[model samples]
Target: MSSEETLKRLALETLEQDADRIVQLIRVQMDNLTMPQCPVYEEVLDTQMFGLSKEIHFAVRLGLIDREHGRSILADLEKQVSDVHEAYYEHREQLKKANK
Candidate 1:
């Protein structure tokens, strides 16, 4: 395949993998936090947030996603990540609850 096509495929795969990992991590954190005493929960939460930010930064550096395009396409995804994190303290919340 052409380089553009390869890059596009790589970009899509990277985003998909990141999204899945983030959601899974969020779910685990939410599940663990259902109990009253989880000391490491906050740390795990912070790590996931940092991971998402890092993924965005990587995408920017690789030029796979332009800022303007990301603003339009990924804005909602980023917001969902933030919102899911905010709702992490809630027992019934799921990362899947965020926009897909």
Candidate 2:
């Protein structure tokens, strides 16, 4: 196979492997109790999340996959993270109200 094809295949495989882990990280962050309480924890979590995003961008730029396709996939993943965050906060608010 051509180099481009090989890269594309690799990109797909990497996405398959890392996508779940990325989402899990986001879920953990959303549900984290101590993240807001600790500046260091928040910073570390942010750094790791952003780092994963950057890695995906770099992979596309490096021709690991079609740039447009990779961007679409990343966009979907971002939306998922947003949804998770929204749900997490909503649940937290409900819990707080219940305790009142």
How does each model score on TM-score?
Answer: 0.56, 0.66
Which candidate number has the best TM-score? 2
CA shift at 16, candidate 2, in angstroms?
A: 3.9
Q: Which residue runs of candidate 2 sit more than 4 Å off their true CA positions?
A: 1-7, 35-42
lDDT of 1 by residue, 1-100 (tens): 9998798678767776766676677666655654323557666656765676677667768888766654543555556656765676552454446734
lDDT computed for candidate 2: 0.72
State the C-alpha lDDT per candidate. Answer: 0.63, 0.72
**Which 10-residue window in model 2 sums to the lowest lDDT?**
29-38
Off by over 4 Å in 1: 32-39, 69-100
Q: How much does candidate 2 score in TM-score? A: 0.66
